[model samples]
Target: MIVLPRAMMPIIVACWLYYLLGVVVVGQYEWQTRDAFDEIRMRMDKVNDDNCQIQHLGDLYLPEDAVSHLPDIKDININPVFPNRTALLHLHNMALSRSFFWSYILQSRFIRPAINDTYDPGMMYYFLSTVADVSSNPYINASAIYFSSNMSYSPSYRGFFNKTFPRFAPRTFRADDFNDPIHLERISTRNTFTVQDLGAFPTTRLSDDYTTDFYRINEWYKKWLPDNVDKRHDTKTTYQIEIRYANNTNETFTFHGPPGADEYPGPVKWTRPYFDCGRSNRWIVAAVSPVADIYPRHTGFRHIEYPTYTAVSVMEMDFDRIDINQCPKGKGNSGPNRFANSARCKTDTTEVYI
Candidate 1:
C-alpha cells in the first residue's frame, strides 16, 4: 500500500476510532434498553395475579342444616374414577373459558341487555335454585347466582370484584367491576382456551392418602411435623394458565383450589361422566406446594422474570346431583337440563318432567 502523509494518516486513524467507538456505544445502549424492557415486563407480570377477577360464591343460599362445613362435603368418600377423561379435559377447558372469561366478557357486556330484557330474574333465580337443590355442594349452587347477577348487570372494568366474596349485589361491589363490556367481550371472544406450555418448574409430590378437610388436615399436618413443617408442604397446587392476546400481550394466570381454611377446600372431586383419565385429564390437582416452585415449566423462563402466582379457591359442585323437581318446566329441551347420568345418583328413578 502507498504510504500516506502524516496529516492524512492521523485523519484516517481518527475515522477508524470513531467507527469502533460507535459500534461499542450502540451495542451497550441496545443491551441496556433490552434489560430495562425485561425489568418492566417482570414488574408488570406481578400485577397479573392481582389483576385477575375471580369471584367466589361461598355458602350464599345453603340452609344452615345442609352440609355447611367444608370438611363434611369434602369427605364424601367418593373416589372419582375419571371415566371419560377426554370429556373432563374438554370440560375443564370449556369451564376455564366459559365460566371464567367468556361468560364474563361476552354475556356480561353485549348479551347482558338481551338476557336481562328477555329473561326474568326470577327465571334465572329459579334455574339457580334448581341447581342448588340437587348439588352436593350448596356453595357451588349459590355461587351460580352471583355469576348470573354479574352477567346481568354488565358492570364496568372499574366496578369488577377483584377478591373472593361469599355474596354480592349490584349496589355493593368492588371498583374492578368497571363497565367495559365492549372491551371485555373483545378479549373474551377472541382468546383461545387451551392448556399453556410453561417450560418447567419444581414440583412437590402429593400424598396419595390425604385428608380433604382443611381444619383436620391443618391440625394433622401441624402435629405430623411439629419440628418444622415447610410452608410449601401446606401450599396448594396451582396451574399456570397463559393467555396470549392478539396484540402480543401475554398474561399468565395461576389457578388453584381453595385453601385449607375455606369451606369445601381441596382439589375438586372429579367424578365419572365428568373427568375421565386421558390427555384431556392431563391436568391433575395441584399438590401441596408453593406456586413459585411448583410448575417447573413456567418457572423455567430464564430470560423473563416470572410473576407471583395466586390461588383461586371456588367450591365446584356436580351438576348431576341437582333434583329435577326444583327445575322449571320450559317449552324446549334448553331449559333445566338435569344430570340424569351422574355417577353420584345412579339408581335414582326420578322422571325428568322438563
Candidate 2:
C-alpha cells in the first residue's frame, strides 16, 4: 500500500462535499418542477370549474322569469333575443374565445414562473376591452361573470389594472380621434395596411371610442387610476377593437401607431387572440422600444420585438353549419369548423344557481 500525503485527504474531502452539494441542488430543482406541475394542475382544475359554471349560465334562458331576474342576471338586456342556430354558433365561438383567453392567463400567471418580466398596464386594459366586446352578447357576458370572479382572485391581475393601469395617462379624444381619413393616413404612413389587417378598421371613423366610452361606463375604474398621472404621451396607451357575434362569441383586435410616428413615442404590443397568427384570428401591432432606452421595471411584461407587427387569425366558421355527428368523438374533421369536435367542447355551467 502506498502512503498518501495529508494534503491529499483534504482535496478528497472537498471533492466529496462538492458532489454532495450538486446532488442537493439537483434534488431541489426536481422538487420545484414537481411543485410547478402540481400548481398548474390545480389552476387548470379551477378553470374547468369556472368554465362549467359559465356554460350553465349561458344555457339558462329563464324566459318567464327573465324579467324578474333582470338585476340578478349577470347580463341583463331589456328585450333579450333568444339564441337561434346562428346565435348558438356565436355562443360556441364566444365560449372558445373566453376559454382560450383564460387558459392563457392561467399558463402565464400560475404555470410559468416570471422571468425577466415587465408589466404593461395597457395589456390589462386591452384585455378588459376584449372582454367588453364579447360581453355585448348577453350570453357571453353572462358567461364572463364567471371569468371576472376568477380574475378577481389573481394577484398579478389585481396589481396590473388596479394598481398600475392608472399610472399612464390615456389619450384624449379630439375630432381627429374619430377622423378615419386622418387616422388612415397616419396608419398608411406607418405602412400599417395589409390584406391581413384583421378588419381593424371596420369603418374610417371611430365607431367605438374606448377612452371616453369606457370611462363613462366604468366610473369606478376612473377613480382607480392615479389622479395626477399624465394622460398624454404614454406610448403604452392604445386603442383596441373588439367584435362579438350574436352567439356570445367574440374576438379582440388591437392597433397602435409606431413609436415617434405620432405624439405617443414608445413601444407598444397587442395581446388578445394568441401571439401566433397561424393559431388564432386576432391581430396586434406594436412599436418597438428604442435599443438604447432603458424601460422602467415591470413596465411591459410581455415584450415582442419592436417595429414588428403580428396578426393571429384563427379560422372561424358558423357553428350552426357544423355536423357534429359526421365527425368521430375525438377526431377533428378537415375544413373551417375544426373546433366543432366534441373533444374541444369544454363547458362550464355551475355559475347558474336555480
Candidate 3:
C-alpha cells in the first residue's frame, strides 16, 4: 500500500464517504422502483367484482301499492341432469363470454339514444341490429336463440306484448302456441269486439290461460320448475334474492328456483344445463346477468357503489351446437418417414426382426 500525507488523509476519507452515500441512494431507489412495479402488476392482475354486489330497490321508498305492482325478475332454475365434463367446461366458457357480451351491450353508447329520449322505435331497431351484427360469429353457432329483457314499463314493448305476443303462462308444452302472429291477431280482434258481441262467442277455441298480466305469469311459473329436476318434494325449492343497499339495509325476495344452488345476488352466473320446453325446446345452458342502473340517493344525493336491478339479460346456447371432442381428430396416427435412400438405425437392437 502507498502511504499518503496526513493533509490528504481527510480528503481521501471524505471522498470514500461520498461514494458510500451515492451507493446507498442508488440501492434505495432501485428497491423503491421494484416495489412500485410490483404494485402496478398486482393491480393489473386483480379481477374486478364491481358488478357482483346486489342493490335493494326497496331503498327507493316507493308507495306500498306501487311497490306491489312492480314485476318480479325471475331466475332460471338449474337442471339436475348434469352434462359431461367437456361439455360443462365448454358451456362455462360460453357463459363467461356471453356475460361480457351482454355487459358491453348494456353499457354501450347505443342504448342511451333509445331510452334516454322518448323510446325511439328506430333506435330500438338499430340497437337490435348492433346485437345481431356482433353475434354473427360462426363458432358461436348463429342458430342459437336469444331474447332481451322484458320491459313492461316501455309502451312500445307493452304494446308488442299485448297485441303482437300475448304473455301466456309457462306450461309443460305449447307455451308459445299463442306466439304465432295469426293467433295474436285473432286474440286482438276478439278483445276489440267484446262490447259488440258479448254473448255471441260463448265458447272460444283458444285456452283461457293466456293473459297480459305479469302477476298471473309469475304465479304460473311458480307452480312449475324446469322439466328435468325432481319436483317430488312437498315444499317447492325457493331462491332468496337479497338486495343490499348502501345504507346498510337489505330486502329479500323469494322465488322458485332449483334446489341445492347458491343464492344468485346479481352477478354473472351460469345456470345448470337444462332442457327448456319453451321457445328453444332443446338442451340448453343460460348465462344470466342483471342489467343495473345507478341512481342517486334521495336524502344525500350519494351515489351507491352497488348496482340497482333494472332487468336481467339471458344468453342461451344449445348443447347440440357445440362439439365437445377432447382429443385431436388424428393425433398419433401417422408413422415416421422410412422410404428415404439413407439408412437409419433401428434403436431396438435387442429384439430380432421378423
lDDT of each: 0.27, 0.29, 0.31
lDDT of 1 by residue, 66-185 (tens): 211112223334533233232323323322332233212222222223322222233234234323322322212111112211122212222322322212211100112233475664
Q: In model 2, where do residues sit more than 4 Å from their true spots? A: 1-83, 109-112, 116-354
Candidate 2 per-residue lDDT, tens place, 1-354, comes to: 989899799998999999999998887643323332243234324433224323332221111211111111122244343333334435434433433343233223322344523232233453353445333543221121111111222234432323322112111110112335657644322222112211222334342222233212212122121122243434333334576879998867443322222333122211111111121111111111111111222235444212111111112222112222223324322322312232322244557678
> What is candidate 3's lDDT per residue for 167-254, written digit by digit as tens?
2111111122344476855342211100111111223423222221221211212221112213332232333456677999887644
**Poorly placed runs, candidate 1 (over 4 Å):** 1-234, 258-266, 269-354
Which structure is stronger by TM-score: 1 or 3?
Answer: 3
lDDT for 141 (candidate 3): 18
Segments of candidate 3 deviating more than 4 angstroms: 1-116, 119-123, 126-135, 139-267, 295-306, 321-354
TM-score ranking, high to low? 3, 2, 1
Give lDDT for model 2: 0.29
TM-score of each: 0.19, 0.20, 0.28
